[model samples]
Target: MPSIHDILTKAVALHNGGQPERAAALYRDVLAVEPAEPHSLHLLGLQMRRAGCEAEGIALMARSLLLAPTLAPALFNQARALQDSGRLDEAIAHFRRKLEVDPNCGVTSIVLGNEALARGRLDEAERILRRAAALEAGGAFASRLRRALERVTTARGIARDAADPSLPPGLVVRGAFRDSSGYAHKVRQFVRHLVDAGVRVRLVDLNHGDVDNLPDGQIDPLLHTLDRPVRAKAVLSFTTPLVVEAVPNLKTINYTVFEALDIPPLWAAHSRRHDHVVVATDSSRRAWLQAGHPADRVHICPEGVEPLEPGRVAPAAILDGTGRRLADYRVRILNVSDLNSRKNLEGLLRVWLRTTRAEDDAALLLKAGKGDGASGSIRDLLARLTAETGRTLGEAAPLFLVEGKLSDTDMMSLHAAATHYWSMSHGEGWDLPMAQAGAMGLTLLAPDHSAYHAYLNGRVAHMIPSHVTPALDGYRGRDWWTPDEAAAARLLRAVIDDPDGTRLSAREHLLEHFSWRSAAHRLIGLLGGLDAL
Candidate 1:
């Protein structure tokens, strides 16, 4: 094996040659061999920033700066990382420090001027950019410096996602309203918060079709903002990347998610027409960045969950296969899902077989959505399991799978009928049903991967183990995993054996941490001042 110095030298060469992924692997190798190598630390941090892992990169570079305070590259990279993260004060402070180290650094002056301009420090911006203009008269950054100078007097104060749309000036939310697909559900949920947060949002119903469980006509007149006219300079589109429109003068922010290991390159390419990409989780953000979206233009704003529907009580009863009502079970473990491949229905069924017995008073309530021959698909899954494991679902505990067209009120009733909600999904991108279940006081159990870590902690729910596997199907997210069926089985038996009502007590924490009001206010803050929204 080469020494750490030799490995680092090669890593730096690769890093400079624009092979960050390969260079990053080598830098990690250097860290593994000599954990506190400051050079390796800072270089790896820069690579991380390039990949849009700003927080991680900043932390790594901070550590490197602490270890090697005199490292100029560390300071420069750390300053860039902070700038990429939109921390104007810290970023400007670091840029000033770098300029102090070398007052004649034209690139440093240009960036400092630009940031100062963004902070509305016109005099400071003009002075710095003038110096930069003189120093880099005909250099590579001449045109960029010229642009920065032109914007100095015109620049405004920084907001997360400022109202810089090229059209007149307003925000329009474009998404499908007449559907209840995952995309539609999330869009509707976000609109609820945005409107509640006091935004005068206009709507542009996409009306594209994938799933249409929701009825036509406005579900909530206030939520739809149905009264507002549709004419705006900015659009917050909650559709997939393929439908991204290249409308000039409109600042488009694509609000979407990905459960797969990655997004299609074509989708990623199309999304570039939009101004920014906002997602609900860091994993989703990383996927967009990895698929070639700009690091600084991608961001995370976590989704919130509330009761299934406020003030609407579910129907009184739900019958299981054995004619016993769902309420009859001592412990009703629920999973509201569709027949999607990534849901890992096979893993769920296997766990159900491995753990519970017919004598057990617990039941698994699957409120699966109706799809094309969705009922027959369950039979096919059971048949596959029987051939593979030589055991049937009947030999285990009662499995109650509910597949039907349910109204929102009826769905709330389904949640009311369950004691617990669980999933062994291969992946997720902010699971709405699971979040709703947890919010409704269902003792939640989920695998330790993807968006599950966003809310559920050990104190709140039983978290199962997960192992990284090849991305199922063709998901373009960084990684996916298979939940440990054995571990899930063990948890199920423990919960079944000892029913603890205290598990439901943590539901309040979920509400407190992920309220619609709070999440909406955050989105509002990003768009402009809360009052501006």
Candidate 2:
């Protein structure tokens, strides 16, 4: 005996609460009472879609919209269903019709912009997304609109660059090249390529941490242009996004990466001020997007492998207080990680202990350090993991730990020291060390997840199967990859058994497919796509 209004309200609540059958019954009751109840028809249509009757639902929703022409939600749902059903043109027509009906419909605008992007109309997509962003100013859809515009900007760049294969204007680069971290090396490589591509470059040194490595800074001296009142198009920062200070009136892009699913709060907050976020991998971009950054605003500019320089390569690791080299082992397996949980160094150790024995003619060269907001030593943790596994390192193959500051040449020497490189990382922005090792023609093994997939296949490098697991300490929100220790041990044994089977021309593949020059040009193109930054 409920009123039509009461019945409709109950139907909506039931529908939202996942009691679709009950909601559909109420919707039917409402329609029985008032045969032309548009809301009831609309709700009933949605229930039909949930029941796998997509065509019937679309027809009913159409009928409902015809009866009550201004049912915004009904129109939106019908359009979405049509889009899902592959009626893209019809779906777009419906979205455009929705804007005509509502005028300030941000969702419709977003949809239209996406359709334009799918149709390769980058300019149109940018215009629509911009308009939508302004319309939904400070609302829930603003982030989405901003992200859409970022994509349109990138798409425009790709389209233009493909047509005209010329480099854009040089960018003003600002990043930490003085440090001995992976970040510093990535910036150096990027700068080297940018300068080589005939791009006008200016460098601003940002020494973030430990600058005490021997053979101090000299990053392609051609970047030392002292142009005042910097008329450069954009400022590209290569340090942590958390530390980037935005340039006034210039588009600021913070080039950074993270090795986990969850980004630190401060870093996420700081990146908001920048005009765009450029990450080395999609994994890094996802961390920002998952943390509520605009998707389009964060773009992927993949890091590249540096081609090997044989004469310049130096050997750097010294083992167990003895001047023994990693080269001493017949099968030298190397892993570079720090004290960060996301590095999953413990996983690597577990694999090592389970796979190798005392007389196994193999050694694990752990080039360990402390970086990416990690403090504390790796010794205690490894000892604890070793103890918990009911095994002693003395009974297993040699586990040589190397924690020293090495120069750029020495770092290459460290890679040169190994016969193979392996990582069991939870995630990575772009594991530069892993790439560098592969470039040095070492047998590569990594988890089949995250940034590793960008370069490897079963044929190119051995893959450690992984599954979704709860992210450990520090990295909280999203789930991360956990390599199967047993499977990894098997692969480790398999590769060692047939060392010839591990014969992948990793150096050639990495250098050819992931060129530093190509990465720099794409970066330049991404900036040029933006509407006069």
Candidate 3:
């Protein structure tokens, strides 16, 4: 057998070469001979972590540290593992211990600074990053540290501005404001309402791109103002609440949209980080309460809808993939959703094909987006459906898959062209498109549950009969509603029979209940209530 030194050397080499399993076996062999060998135990712990055994890795690392308390590498590795596991507070403690062991560890300082930056501790991040810069002069690490320090300085300045009393009482809205996403649309509409109501606001677009082709011009001025510090009365964050943990010394409202009954442990923790949690519907509020959040801290603030201008006509013809005009169809049914299992496109397609024949002169226009791997699945399903129905593209197949980044005007045009807006979503945080379509005076066909219940009524919507079912995908283990196929088919036929009356009623009911003015009033009241707390 080789000596411990030779075995340790080979294990280290293997570990560095990314052969963690081989390295772990060698380290275990070394430990079998000398059970308290600190190096063997530390290296094995890191290997175990790499192999996806986090708890075992942490245990081994702890034991190694017990044997050699000043093991700098072991301490650093443990801290990194803890941080990766979202045990940020524990990670900070471990990093502090590592610094104590090796006071001049520049890499440790940089890591600590980065962790601080992630946690939104700007002052601490700047301090540690400056120390890292001093320790690592004239190197890549030093250059990186300097850049990080500059960012920290800028962030600190922004935080200061956020807390400034000199500026008018305003709101700083942070979210994916530029994307063609539901969240982005909600933020855009809400910001528009605030501005229209004569309130001061600044937008922090987190979508990481230039704001292009957004529907409203109000977002234009805010885009150029992103680089400036935001001095606002409050920060309303539409992003995940986990971000609020980094933003200290401000009253933060966590604006979240939860589709399921049960909240995940991680999300619940993030929700508690904010001063208040604003949910889109009463069902969402109940979910937070069930997840152990304080009832007083969770408030219901439903989203608003902006209808398209009246008298706007759809294009005379929409070009299909082959550039052929699909204008022969008499009726258009529009379904806009991020193509995913939750949207239940599979079920929707099945029901549509089963209900309407090719001779019905109706087209199902699927305006789908936002799924990374969902396009392939959608194509496959469409192909299967086409074969089953014996329909060719654009003629026998009455389905058009429209996928791209659509402008607001383009979206409104699609809604205007459609005779009915349809969805069979398993769940919804708040189905923005459904509400928008309703506001646009388009007849709706959706389940009468979740966020739909907040606005959809018999007066406006043809509520499809649905049964409760287990949620799919990210909402696993929670209950959601699935629309009855036969009932949906009946509703689809009913809407086609009386399109104008159904559209008028839907538009009236949606405008009465889901207006931006109402949402903004509720929001302003909620912000005022936060002050009393």
In terms of lDDT, the best-performing candidate is 3
Model 3 error, position 451 (Å) = 1.0
TM-score of 1: 0.65
Instruction: Please write out the lDDT profile of model 1 over residues 207-272, one tens digit for every residue.
Output: 333344566443665654443443454567787765543333446677788775566555675566
RMSD of 2: 12.4
Best by TM-score: 3
lDDT of 3 by residue, 284-308 (tens): 8877888899999999888988755
TM-score each candidate. Answer: 0.65, 0.63, 0.73
Pairs with backbone N, CA or C atoms under 3 Å apart (clashes), candidate 2: 147-296, 314-413
Candidate 2: 10-residue stretch with minimal lDDT:
222-231
Query: Which scores greater on lDDT, model 1 or model 3?
Result: 3
lDDT digits (tens) for residues 1-533 of candidate 2: 67999999998999999999999999989988898889889889999987868788998898898999878888888888786564656767778878888878887887787666545466677788888888999998776666656556544443343234254444567776656678777777888887787766656666333355434443444434422222455677787764564443456678888777757555666677678888878778888887788887988888887786654576664566556555677888888887678888888887777677878778888877732322236667658867888777777788777666655666777788788899999887788888888878888988888888777777778888998887766665457889888988998887666777666657778888787877888877776786322
- How does residue 213 of candidate 3 score in lDDT? 38
- Candidate 1 stretches with Cα past 4 Å from truth are 1-170, 210-213, 223-227, 307-312, 370-372, 476-478, 501-505, 529-533
Query: Which sequence of candidate numbers ranks them by TM-score, best first?
Result: 3, 1, 2
